[model samples]
Target: MSELSPYEIAFLSGGPTRVAQTALLALYESDRIRVSRGTHRVEVLPREPEDLHPVQAAVIDQVPGTGRLLGAVLEAVAAAPEVRAVADALVSGGLLRAGLRGALRPTGEGKALRRGFETSPGEGDVLRLAALGPEGVQDAKMREILSTDDPKPVKMPKKPKGGHRDLDSSGLSDTQYSAGL
Candidate 1:
């Protein structure tokens, strides 16, 4: 198998959110997106015609909410509240492409990563992994497994048999007989 790129690795571990988060982090690291030391917002700049992956280019175009810190932006976009907007922005920006039957398809390295986090197991796993990265997922799984305590089934006691000596042309005994019953 071919070695996974950082984007691919990020995708396999989680999903589109992780992929976008990884892209943003990469862009920031490369100085394509700059964050001030004391500021929460990041600055997105237009590219200057250089060799770049489509995802990077997409993110460069879709500069998102400018209120939170650099790290907070990634986390929030990767998680609740802003995640939906971020995802829509990613799709529009071309960082994300819809797949067969509207599944999350890889644009570049995302295809090569070869992940089914959205399908295999279930969508819940994909969302879970997305919400809690790889380490967090493992920790949660371990906690779940460890939290469960199995116990042997207890056998129910059988009732005493043969209270009636005989039946009066009926299969039922005296205990079963009643007025018009």
Candidate 2:
């Protein structure tokens, strides 16, 4: 499998311009990798493995949840300024295409560049919540799950035995009942 250089990886990760610049600088310093910036695409030659920078790792970590928006990726990376710079750099390098909503999405080349940063959730990572029945109904199963050994007594309002009615008729208008006086 062909590997991606640090610069390529940074550009693909998608962040502010400054962050991409820093990543590119780091990649340039390393001899194992080569970079090609063009209007059509940014290509990385002779990709090599290197320790991931903290910023890159953060962005990668957050990508799964916030891949839809550049701003979301910035929030994940917690680098506001860097996110903007990286976004500009990626667009300039042809690593990403600008969308109608001012968001950046990975191009074909960009996907290949981010292979090393992929991650998956591990086993036993269950999300626990109160199980609800259909339409938020408190079904028997839900009730069983929620019921405790010492359940609190539910206080129900007492209803009038003879139904609601005014005991005193002092304010009654003759026209109200239309009864013969």
- Measured over all alpha carbons after superposition, the RMSD of each candidate to the real structure, in angstroms, is 22.1, 23.9
lDDT of each: 0.49, 0.39
Task: State the lDDT of candidate 2 residue by residue for 1-181, as single tens digits.
Answer: 2443333344455344324333423333344222222111112334455576554444444434212233333344445444555456666776688778977787787665444343321111010110111112133332232121223334444447955454343454676577655
Model 1 lDDT on a 0 to 1 scale: 0.49
lDDT of 2: 0.39
Deviating ranges (above 4 Å) for candidate 2? 1-11, 14-79, 116-181
Count of clashes in candidate 1: 2
TM-score of every candidate relative to the true structure: 0.37, 0.27
Taking the tens digit of each residue's C-alpha lDDT, what string does model 1 give over 1-181? 2433444445545565575555665565566776443333567755577876555555555556453344444544445433444446545544467889986554664443334433332333323334344333343532242123323334444445945433344444565456555
Instruction: Give the best candidate by TM-score.
Output: 1
In model 2, the worst 10-residue window by lDDT is 125-134
